[model samples]
Target: MAALALFGGIGLSEQKAKETLKNEALSGLLAQAIQQAQDICGSTLDKATGTLLYNAATRLKDQRRLGFLVNYIANKGVSSDLQLNASLDYIKNHPVDPIDTEDFERECGIGVVVTPEQIEEVVEATISKYRNQIMLDRYRFNMGLLMGEARNELKWADGKIIKNEVDLQVLNLLGPKTEADLEKKAKAPKQKAATETTEDKKESEVNGELHIAFERLVGAGSARGGESTNNVPPATATATAPPLMIPSVSLQPTQVSVPNFPADESKGFHTVPITSTIYIEQSDFREVTEKGYKRLTLEQSVGLRHAGYVISVQRVLRNKNGKLVELEATCRKSDMAEKPKAFIHWVSNPLMCELRLYERLFLHKSPEDPSEVPGGFLSDINPNSLVVLGDAMLDVSVRTAKPFDKFQFERVGYFSLDPDSTEQKLVFNRTVMLREDPGKI
Candidate 1:
């Protein structure tokens, strides 16, 4: 079942992987219950018996006595569906822990297959045997649920882990319960400290069964995930205690580092960094080669800013022609560590330039198909693949760049001054982008 349903595809995204893990854990719990029921019914298990046992334990919510019911019903004259229904109705209302096999057999007018001692043994083995494993499964299930809830409320960058303030509220709430549970038994609420971060306060407010269980496990330092319980001091009833943030969680999936550039793996355009210089050959453009020149869009200039390139626009006057245009400018190290948001390398004199951005070179046969081949694949080519940014403004620093000189366009792509560039006009052709720096191309 898992092979066909769980792994139908080749690769799984982080979210998809989490969902599969959650479903597996849930199925494991249910399967464990089925095995426990079958143990008491011996080697003659049937579909009807299995369905009844599953419904009684899960849907009816009778976790305590499913084993006894199985033993009493399966070893008797209750072979008919009518008799089975009557017996199940009786078991659902009665408490099985106190009933011995002799009484159960008498009530059903049939001798029990498993003895009373054997029933006791099965009960003990299945009920408390995998308590720890059950707790761990519950933890995984709850984490998956919380992540789904948080994702709806947060603005997450693609491929980034949940880290924003709103999502942190859900993460922090993974403690045993609400913040109130952190206090020692019978203790008054602790006073909030002036130094507490805003996050510390929010975690204390959300309440749920999962949060309470999480606190219990972490507080005892027995949680399977090794989450920290020492952050907040246990509350004492007799004295005033200091307020602290809820305990920290270290879910297994959360520990792995998020990839810098996550792409649609089904396609072939893997990420490659832009380190060297590239020269744009206008002759290489599909339009210039096959047709005529096309105008660039101003929206493309706005899109570049989102990719981490700080393009500055300043009013400047041309010395020779006295043309009025915004001096388009970019700093070489705008993406460097510890740079101010306002920092940019602006030039007094602006240059008339054009930037050509390229998308995937080969056409995909279908959205699901990954092959990008030669002749036939060209028919599936994306016409809007390349974006041209003409009528652009550039800073004076670009004047120093030769025709072949390459400059990494921060988060954008690698570009070189066009060979067709002259004193009157400048052009740049994009080579390849480093990564999928979100927002726009």
Candidate 2:
């Protein structure tokens, strides 16, 4: 019945029915065009964005029609003549580079330097978590980078680029495996197929040997100057394994240029790196002064806290001169158990310090108390929550500390060189207490 209505079965001919259907289709296309024009009526286009749209239109080969459409859009405030023209220029002038490469050649280029710590952490974590050939290969490359070798920025035939530094952080944070576990796994033999004949098994073994040889060739070629600086032992081969046959492959000297990496000057690439031994903040200090004693802000007491004057210090470990000589001893919990009695903290350098002592921010009252309402937590604000230790001691090293430099005081909490600190009078701000439970004696 619907088909008959469309064909007008009571009076319409076949030719007329076909003509009606064609007209309907044309009307639908026109409606869609109108909708598209309305949708793009009021949008601004930048050069890059305009170029993309213009290039797509150009592919349609309707140059005259496209020119009129561009003008109409520009006049409608959706685009501009300058932007469109720039895009047109870009489309005509942009260089086309080969995305896919068939080169079986190796290219060696200098990559970023990685720290020994970063390499150790990343390798340990990767070995434990993934333990695959691809990941292990990456770890080896990263190790080379740490040892001052330029890491190979491998560009696969399909255009995929493997950037070691980009993946280093994520791999480092993964839980690391023990060296014993890693060694055990490395020595483990690859399982063989149960149904395979001896001849097939021999072929598989030969293939495996060939793969190892191929890796060595690639690794050596990729290093440019010769063997990699990654001194770590091969994870796949056993110490006593017989030498395998090297596959016959022609060597070709070639260069593959990769995108230049962004500059990161803070990685100690061109500057001396400072390693922190300890960190003490205001929260770490016990009440050397009497509780509720007048707390003066460092700003308020800068004049009184003179050089060589004792502010407050406690003997943390066994030392006659009261100095932490061993860097590793600072991190040992066992060593902390042998700490000495409270001593005077002296100012070795001219320093203005604001020591903020921790106090209960709010007081809790019993539910049955007459004055206690549910929302009374705000009213119970501890007036002594912030005690400013204006007169504080600082070591001579504080002078060299740039603004915002964080370091641990001998017995205090982690403190930062305050932004307000100056060359004439260095200022230190107590950031936090050493312990989470500040009330603990």
Candidate 3:
């Protein structure tokens, strides 16, 4: 049953490898491209992006140049489907397109990564200009204004970062939420923070749950991907509570001096600080002796994201207030000669994000079947279908994504850029998981 509907809700990646596999003409090109993409990102190219491989392989038949362009497109792609389609169309129309061609950057984004400072400057300036309006509207402000101004300045800037910076700056300007604001937010239809806080308060009237919910609402929806688990040890925020982000985070970013790595593994370590000061998700670090945990547990060494190096956690460092503010780990340099058993995705200076984790709207696969679901499809609605992660730390690579841009988050799920995204948050609708769970099947 799971296999049957695996690709059912994939809005953009609907056409999986099977589509190319059935088409012998495109299959070989996809096979070749997938090999390259796997080496680069350890995943298959989004089927939507995979079309370029056919164009590159067929149009510009030079094997070496073909390999280079394919690699570039896989690593750094054009922003939207329209642009990707345009690139594909260009390759088909033109008889040739080498690495030196002017059309590469002109048509698609065959460019460099937009640095954090450059992005920060734009975000800071734009928010300062609209400070009064943003403060007044609070989360109700049309965040797109801030995003539009920033993106106008830097089209290639990570949309994730822009939204994060905007959220951070706005929240900072607004200060803490007043009870009136929370009550008003609670009255709002989808103001996630208010709803979650309300729910937590209901679960336990204790101040601790309220405090945790406040942290979750203010914290990061967060960046990159990391190993996720259901169980975790008790952890607290940093002594300097900059932004109360999530507990599901990996370790903070570190500088790993790797003299060399496999040619295909990385172009270079694009070290972007995911956060300042260290407040790792205790989930990323568990108590020692929890065998097969595969993260930075006590005495266990794990590799850091972006930068490649292993850090063995000697002990957990807490503040005078007993807050889990830092991790004391010993760094040992290592080369990415081959894929390590596990690598941790950490954020040193991460952008704040809101991730809307969606599930099936209706409980029954065939909701319309009265025989399967009593009182019809309407009654089979899944009330807890949407879980909002308001303060998620997100990678900036996804920052400049235009609305409707689709991506498969490494281990999380396939997500679509929902129209609900605003100045306060870049809302993503979870289209589907990477694959179906056997239990659900």
Candidate 4:
């Protein structure tokens, strides 16, 4: 009867029942479309989400701009709403590079960096609570019991970070690595240098960051460039940053390009000596502050991005007339222990240069359209289209960058070497902003 109504047979159904039933062949077309959709996106909603999640994870695997997606996937649980909102947010905040790890993570509720100490405590407690079982099971035991239990308590923390702590705790209890365990580890295939993988890649699931003082409880650390003179007006505030140590002894070149990474960086990258004086932009530090400002003001800490070291400001260095010029700082290696509020990009022995930032030439998107711009297109011309920074500084990583060479300055925008440059001076033009914003420089 319902089918008859759709066939225009509610009143004529008595005579047209046979005719209405004949449309089954047409309905098969609808069925075919559904079958095609199911083939592309799994048959059930659960299967569809699983496929989506897998694709999202795999596609975003090498993408640092996206936060540790494995962590997001593992923790997203069963809430489609949660998954959708988080995914949308990450897309919205996506950058030319990684989401600004400093602010983006905090804003998206990735929460503070779970310090090595905090992780150790949680792992120890979880293990101690189940000590008898761990002793009984040994290698045969479901180690994830420790992992899952600890993860429940620290939901916002990265799994790999937590896994490292768990490994250390379990080993301390289990004592020396048996020849069998060592051989098992040795037999495992090595991954590429660019990718960081664990002895057991299945940390039940999460992957996740930096600094020079390293408290490596276990596992290898990644140290970029042996010696970089790191000056912080920072971005991601690091807490016990991912364990790393720039050898007090420098073996690699002092100034290395970040793009040239993927060499033997275990002892940490090659080093350039820390200059006693490192220049900083005026805005990185603050002399005064208002309420709720979690920055390098009133005792807030910040990290030096990529360098993996934390800078503690002993005194703010200012030039004559009280302008912030530099920082008298002590850099220490991080153990991934404490959460710094922010991290920033800094350069040491940087090259003084000039930068030209560009905005849209017109204030309105459809400047030529009379409806869009009542005034002539000339009247729609934006006055702030060009912003020139004469005091811009660049580090040696890009020293090899010749004219027309393009680079993305993290948290800022994309830039290209300008035609007008001399051996003594360099100038760059902003090719694009990291994102579309009206008044950004």
- Number of the top candidate by lDDT? 3
Candidate ranking (TM-score, best to worst): 4, 3, 1, 2
Winner on TM-score between 3 and 4 is 4
TM-score against truth, every candidate: 0.24, 0.21, 0.38, 0.39
Instruction: Evaluate all candidate structures by whole-model CA lDDT and list the values in order.
Output: 0.32, 0.28, 0.46, 0.43
Worst 10 residues of 3 by lDDT: 204-213
246-325, model 3: which lDDT tens digit per residue?
A: 22133333332211111111212222333223333445555564533555556556544334444565556566888765
In model 1, which runs have C-alpha deviations exceeding 4 angstroms?
A: 1-348, 363-375, 434-441
Clashes of 2: 11
**Residue range 1-441, candidate 2, lDDT tens digits:** 443242332133344334333444322332232334435543333333333232223221223344334433433422332334433344344334321112201111112233333443443444344445423343322333432222222211111111232233323322122232234243433322121011101111111110010000000000001111122210110000111111211211112111111111121111111112111222213224332222211111100010111111222222466533211111111122222221111111113344445644543334234344222333233333455555443333334656665543423344456677766665555455443222222
Error of 2 at 336 (Å): 27
Higher-ranked by lDDT: 2 or 3: 3
Model 4: residues >4 Å from true position, as ranges?
A: 1-274, 288-292, 317-320, 336-339, 436-441
TM-score head-to-head 2 vs 4, winner:
4
lDDT of 2 at 303: 8
Q: Per-residue CA lDDT of candidate 1, range 1-441, in tens?
A: 442232222132234334334454323433554565446565345645543443333332344555555554445444433344445556666754575656545655343233222332332333234434423342232344433443443212221233222122222223223234333444434322212111111112121110000000000000011111233211100000010011112111111111111111111111111111111111111112111111111111111111122222222223355632222222222233222222111111234467677876432425234232211332233333576766544433355456755543422344556798887766767654544332232
Q: Pick the winner on TM-score between candidates 2 and 3.
A: 3
